[model samples]
Target: MSMGTQGAGAGLTRPAPATRAALLVLLVGAACLLLGPRLPWLVEWPAGWTVPATDWVGAALEWLLGGIKPVARGFSEMLRYPMDWADAALAVTPWPLVIGLVTALGWAIGGAPMAALGAVGLGFVLASGYWVQSMNTLALVAVSVPLALVLGMGIGILANEVPRLRGPVQVLLDVMQTVPTFAYLTPLLLLFGFGPVVGLIASAIYAAPPMARNVLLGLERVDSQIKEAAIMSGGSRLQQLFQVEIPSAGTQIMVGVNQCLMAALSMVIIAAVIGGFDDIGWEVLLTMRKAQFGQSLLAGLVIVAFAVIIDRMSAALASERNRQDQRVTAGLVLLAVAVTALFWRSLPDPAGFTLLAPVAEAVDRGLGAFTAANGATLDAIKNGAMFYGLLPLRIGLDDAVLEFTWGFQWTPAMSLALYALAAAGGLVLAFAGRATAGALLVIAVGILETGVANLAWPFVLTGAAALAWLAQGRKLALIVTLLLLTILLSGLFPRALLSLYLSGAAVFACALFGGAIGLVCAVSPLAWRMMRPICDMLQTIPLFVFLIPVLMFFQIGEFSAFLAICAYAIVPMIRYTRHGLVSTPTEMLEAATASGATAWQTMRDVRAPYAAPTILLGLNQTILYAFAMLVIAALIGTTGLGQSIYLALGQADVGLGISAGAAMAILALIADRLVQGFAEERRRALGL
Candidate 1:
């Protein structure tokens, strides 16, 4: 009893690091945000402050590529074996037989409905006379997916096994995922030049990061008890991983495969743009270029069809209970379908029959009908959007920024002075026993040294501090501060800031609309059931495809690009909002109701707060999707970092592309960090 009391007493006497850190940094951060801008040098990086950082990265990539060329060639040659095999097997096979095989496989995986959908999709492609082109796409996928799976799986395992490397690897993955897919073409073409293999390599690279992330998540999320049990059983390290962790992670890893497949499909068209894949993407491009809107629209649908079938199968493979059953059903269904097809083998030749003519006519007519019916209203909306919405929006944006920062042209001396102020603040905090807070100030100073601090540093610092304070996330505030500061010297800070504000606006707009749908879904079962699939379909459409409908309605401009971003990004907001609200614990709601709360009151007090964290995650996805579409939006001519990438691509300047892409990534990471910080705080409050 005496010792226990002593221990408690000692614990009570110990100082809280977080409290000290928060208080110290808060005072210094505020000073920096307020007075530092007036003293321009105080917030800028030091004179001639080049970091000598990027040279190493370029050298590393060059060295790695040079060193691996022979090995890549040998390994890639081996991978071509599967492509060759699939090619030969399907080469002489009738279109009906191929369609039958895929339909049966889909049925085996997801049952009759999915099978029928697969059959329709495959048959439509054949009937549209695009079977050969799609087959070529498949051959590309067949080779790329396997190679990506192996590399992704291996990298994921390595990340899991080595704790020290995980952060760096994950950072790399995050950057890789955020980089515009078009940007990858720069480095890849420089190495492999223009060939199927180059496209194959690029697609594989794009697909691998998602897979690695999923695998890493799968491994990390495994039950600690299960791992302990494996250890107790005297299993070897390899055996424990293979037998326990890998199996447990199976569902998530397979989900990664599903994502990887979709990413590959998305890239197939884009890859074709870069002279890589010459399949359906090429067909769609050629048609679209020639103003063959009907054929182009049909071709785009063909790509979506392929995506749906592959995604369904991959999802079914990921679910443990259905895996075995699917295989069994697939075999039997395929056999029957093959037999049935043999009876009407003559239908395989599209030259004689016009199976898709009706579909083409319907699409063409439907598009015309929509335009004819709504032309005047659409015109009003378009003009209003162009002049009132877009033009006026940017006009007010720079005005909304702090008056002090607008004409701020900072110098090296001013930047060094800001570091001095920060140092002084840290010293005071440290002397007051707030070492962690002081440490953050020191880190923030380092960020200032990098020279990016001059671009909206006051607003950025204020925003971070406020959010961190709201979340009780002092540590995150420091980390995010350092991250934003590191890019200060890049000359991209203003553009990145512009991109973020645009994304923020789009996300806000999406949340308003998405939240309404989510609220309806929350209250009604039928609405939930109907809206879920619509959201899924919205998400499955590729990045640029979102632009097609937007361009058709609004024409190419800021409004059009913003609309495209919203259309593509809103699905996550809708999905996550619905899920978060619907999945709220029934007991919590009951308790709220019992506390003399009305239905609306209970929802506001209980469900909404609990759901906020999840909705934020959805918002995070929305932001990322917005950025992805934001980059693609450059195709229609818009301003910001994405437009920078567009201009850079035009000059074939790989360095500029990389810099602009990295700046966008930095912007994304900042948003991601803020959301994560708040989510953690929410969970802690709930004690979850």
Candidate 2:
């Protein structure tokens, strides 16, 4: 009786942690809001607070570069050597030989149909009077793809073993993958200066992470059954890893390489923006700037064609059937292309080729008329977005956040109280398992603290790192913190929130449309067969390509941005969900069937739970994809951190650009962590 009474008394005295946390958050938030308005200093970032940290970073980079100037030059020169050789060689190389070479590669890798497409694509570029430029882009991709794959493999291999580093590495990769191409110029400029080398360096850096990530995933997924068999056969660690694990993981690695190839090609244009290689990317940008829609469309189509050819070939090579046989043939074809590219100067041109010139022109003309025909409709759509969506979103979210952070009107004591309250709230969140929220709250408090708050950022970062180490055993809390910090510092926290507000709506939209399509197709094998190729094709098309038509139809507004993001990011959602459903273990389905479950019940109870992680992965990819396009869509008037990055890049303001990059990175990380965390937990419970 005494023990029971004591237990009851203890239970009454100690409330649930979640309940306590919620109560504290509510009380603190209420107090801050009520008193915060009166406290100017507490509400807004005060003046005279600044960090020369960027300058320090620049200096450090300069010092490092200067120390390795000689080696840097050598590396730069070595990379340029092949590019220069290809340019000169292609200028004189016979069109027939060039066409035949690509055709052979396509034939060897993907069979006759792909070979024919390759021929058409190569011939079209040659005849269109852009052979030289096309070749330049091609060579860049050829070289960069291999380098990225190799480097990615090396790094992924090393990183996978360092358990503590895995989280931080992933955070870095996620950030890098989505960062705007222009932002990288800051670091590359410091290292390689301006030229094709700059583009090469940037392309490799940008493309490697995906390959690395895929490599890691591939290795982790290698079947323990196969590995154990190798061990029983007395295979050494290195032998088993090389002869067994690597071979088994070929498909994933190939997927990474294919993505790397596409990314490298996409960056060619961006790199040209800042004096890299003179290729299709530059021409595409130039024609667009001149408003020559037909010509720009032509160039864009050519890029798409090239992307298609590469994607198809890579996919065929990675397929289960004839994998070993395909490898040797593919290798030979690639070697032939590279070797032929080397002798470009020796081979005479077949006097102004006869291939895609006419087709390209017709397509260009058709696209021009298409856009023109819809001009009125597009204009109306644009107006609707700007007036209806953009303005309201900006005013309600952006203005509201900024106003609170700025302390629009408040007395000195009120400001101090508001600042103190924000600090306390942030502190509580930090300790209460919502590190992201805590960091944002504290940063708000520090902004209110202004001059001194700027200095406090370092400590905030330290605290986040320390806290992460304590809680998660050294994942990437610092990077997660920095991401939010960047958004705050870039003066875009308000806009960033608004960006998320829009992205959230967009994601929900994708969930509905994409999820429906995927689920419907998954239920029918024949429908899945048809849709799978279509999805794969759509996945190959770059986000920028989607923007051209979206901008035309939507007429350059927030809605255009939203539409583009949806189309670009929705593929992953549909693809992942369908793949998960289709790939569900047969045994589970049988068990559910044995239990007298209907199809829907099996999906909900058996397949859905089994496939949740994959679907969540799709969700994660969708968010990242949406954010990736966020910067590009800014050109159409989407207001947010993306716009800030664009403006900063234009002004050459490194600090502003980096901050925006960091903010976007954190936003992505937060969404990723949320979905990934839940998915991981579910998978663990399901023993998957």
Q: In model 1, where is the ten-residue run with the lowest total lDDT?
A: 1-10
What lDDT would each prediction earn against the true structure? Answer: 0.72, 0.68
**Tens-digit lDDT track of model 2 for 526-587:** 88888888887778886567666664444556787888888888988998898888888888
The list of candidate 1 runs beyond 4 A from truth reads: 1-91, 221-225, 320-354, 357-376, 397-458, 461-475
- Candidate 2: give its CA RMSD in angstroms: 8.4
At residue 35, candidate 2 shows an lDDT of 60
Q: Report the C-alpha lDDT of model 1 over 19-137, residue by residue, as the tens digit.
A: 44455545655566566758665454454654543445455666777787677777666656776777666556666667767877776667777788888888777777677777888
- Which is the leading candidate under lDDT? 1
Question: What TM-score would each prediction reach against the true structure?
Answer: 0.78, 0.75
Q: What is the lDDT of residue 572 in candidate 2?
A: 89
